[model samples]
Target: MSANAQMVAKYKNNFLKEVQEQVEMGEWVKMCMQCGVCSGSCPTNFHPGWEHPPQEIFMMIRAGKREEVLTSPSMWMCTSCYNCIVRCPRKLPITHIMHGLANYAHRLGMAPKMQPTRHFAKLFWNNCVKTGRVNELKLSMGLYFKDGFGQGIKNGMAMKDVALGLLKAKRLNPFEMLGGHKCKDQNGIHAMLKKARELEEKRKAIKAAA
Candidate 1:
């Protein structure tokens, strides 16, 4: 049988089960009705690349299109605006489910390499891990320069207007961005994060064993 056929077979279809086990929000995905309300509510739906909206993604999960669901640009496009959740007749937390899928994709090393949002998320986490806080300058630099120095400069130039607006509003302090900042209790933060990671790993192991 083909891979798709195997996924459709009763015993081989573990996709939904796996999703429910791995992502807290994934349990609600079974309730999706493909009504397209979630898609209509999403701000990113107008973008050309988001082929699978929340409803389609939910159906994909049930259909066991594991790689396609994981690599989909639709999952990465969610802004967590809560619009989908608010409009969902079933009251499914579409925003949370989208984020859960993204995290799951990253955890399984299936995340699409070209996803800028994923890149920013990793950079943001790295910044938080090192200092217990995000230094906007460093985070921005890491994201812009992620591809390379030349790309970074180009990205920076593209955002010049937004940066200038931020500076004018005092939201982006030039001095702080240049100097960076550290948490007051860096050791305590590290210890907490380490414990959290350990617990998360334990949880994953238990789920896998099940």
Candidate 2:
């Protein structure tokens, strides 16, 4: 094969197998006519220092520019408000493509370097898949100490009313917060979480290199 042909083959997007199999909302990518409705409907213009809108990311994916698509800043900024889905001429859920790209970036260890954002996402994902639900108190307290006691105190105060209400409604138990074996399989949960953290660390190292 010619060098150009070989390079093109190497960088081509494998969106077909991915879009067909896992993603439930990606059917419209093929039907996209390059009308800029999605770009116009984006609630806030996050584009800066870029020549094109998010449609370019979709274009790159369609064209098989794997490296460029994965590394683009536009892939990570999706707020998922679904404005583009509502406004799309082809009725494509453009937001889903953004999310699909984000998930792909996360799996590839190439997600953007918003530390707090990344940290919260890691913690949330770990909690959900491992525990089936998030213990927000645990997350908040964890963040508080990581940030500072002042933030903790401020957080506690900000949540004072909510805490009181929860207590009133019997929605929470302080004893549980203090020390409770809420999960029937706490050991299993811990083991799974440990494995998840190790994988996350490995992915971060890989992303650093990528």
Q: Which candidate is the best by TM-score?
A: 1
Q: Which stretches of candidate 1 lie over 4 Å from their true place?
A: 1-12, 205-210
Q: What lDDT score goes with residue 108 in model 1?
A: 84
Candidate with the greatest lDDT versus the true structure: 1
**Which residue runs of candidate 2 sit more than 4 Å off their true CA positions?**
1-24, 47-53, 113-116, 142-210
Name the lDDT value of residue 85 in candidate 1. 95
User: What is the Cα-based TM-score of model 2?
Assistant: 0.58
Pairs of residues at least 3 apart in sequence or in different chains that clash in candidate 2? 13-64
Q: For residues 19-48, could you state the per-residue lDDT of candidate 2 as single tens digits? A: 433333454577788888888878654556
The count of backbone overlaps in candidate 2 is 1
**CA lDDT of each candidate?**
0.84, 0.66
Error of 1 at 72 (Å): 1.5
lDDT of 2: 0.66
